[model samples]
Target: MVKEYILLIIGAVLVNNFVLSRILGICPFLGVSKRLDTAMGMGAAVIFVMTLSGFVTSWCDKYILVRYNLEYLRTIFFILVIAGLVQVVEVLLKRFSSTLYSALGIYLPLITTNCAVLGSAIICATEEEFMGRIFKSTVFCFASAVGFALALVLFSSVRERLELSKIPRSFQGPAIALVTAGILAMAFTGFAGLGS
Candidate 1:
């Protein structure tokens, strides 16, 4: 059991990263990653919502949806669950960390519908390739969030430096950023077999 979850975590965080490899949640990935602090805030918010939604969605799928033969409703169900969970995270952040709340700006609330969060829940709950168990899904979700954070932070650091460096007039802003992202994606591809 432990080894299974360990491999799942490794796979989730490295082999199948939601952002770098799966190409999910590109909005926040580019929008908030300009600043390291904002990226961290967004990453933490995603971690909270993704992990909690993973657990909730898994339980719902197993005990409620499957029991009632309502598997078709899993998508809607997970969306509602993740949206509500994102609200909770927003509230907590507003209460405890006003600075981060302000830093996150619009991207914070955008997490409610982030495809990565929803995908994590849906994939973990329904994908036959995964364990389809609550614990494994939760672990995968957490690791995936961590992987997202890792990638975001790294990119943000490089982007920060890019801000200081001079570049040709043609490749400023998004063009350069996209080029950097391509390089990062290629680097992440090296981790392909670790999860296996």
Candidate 2:
């Protein structure tokens, strides 16, 4: 059981990273990744929202939706939950970290439609990969968020360096970021079999 969860974590975090591998949540992955602090903040928000939604959606699937044969409603339900969660995060951030809240700009609220949050919930709620392993599914979602944070932080660190370096006018911003993200994704693919 322990080894199973470990593999699950490894698969989610390193092999099938939500950002790098599945390529979900690219908005925050790119928008908030310009600075490490912002990256960390965005990561924390995603982690909280993803993990909580994963667990709740799993329960709803097992206890409510599937039981009642309402699986078709999963997408709408999941979005509602994630959007509500983002609102909570927004309120807390505004009350406590005004600077961080403003720094996130529209991207913070944009987490509502972020494919990653919805994808994580859907993966937990329906994916055959998780099946009946509810706890592991939730953990996997949480780890996916962590993996996103890890990649974002690392990318931001590198991009920070790139900013200091002189680059040609054409490849200065998003161009370089995309190229760097592609290379990082390739590096992570090398770990595909590690969980096995």
Error of 1 at 26 (Å): 0.8
lDDT of each candidate versus the true structure:
0.84, 0.84
Worst 10 residues of 2 by lDDT: 103-112
RMSD of each: 2.3, 2.7
lDDT of 1 at 20: 91
lDDT (Cα, tens digit) per residue for candidate 1, span 32-113: 8899988887888788777888888898888889899898998888888778877887788889999877766666677887
Cα shift from native, residue 48, model 2 (Å): 1.1
Q: Can you tell me which runs of candidate 2 are displaced by over 4 Å?
A: 88-108
Candidate 2, residue 8: Cα displacement in angstroms equals 0.5
Please give me the total number of clashing residue pairs in predicted model 1: 0
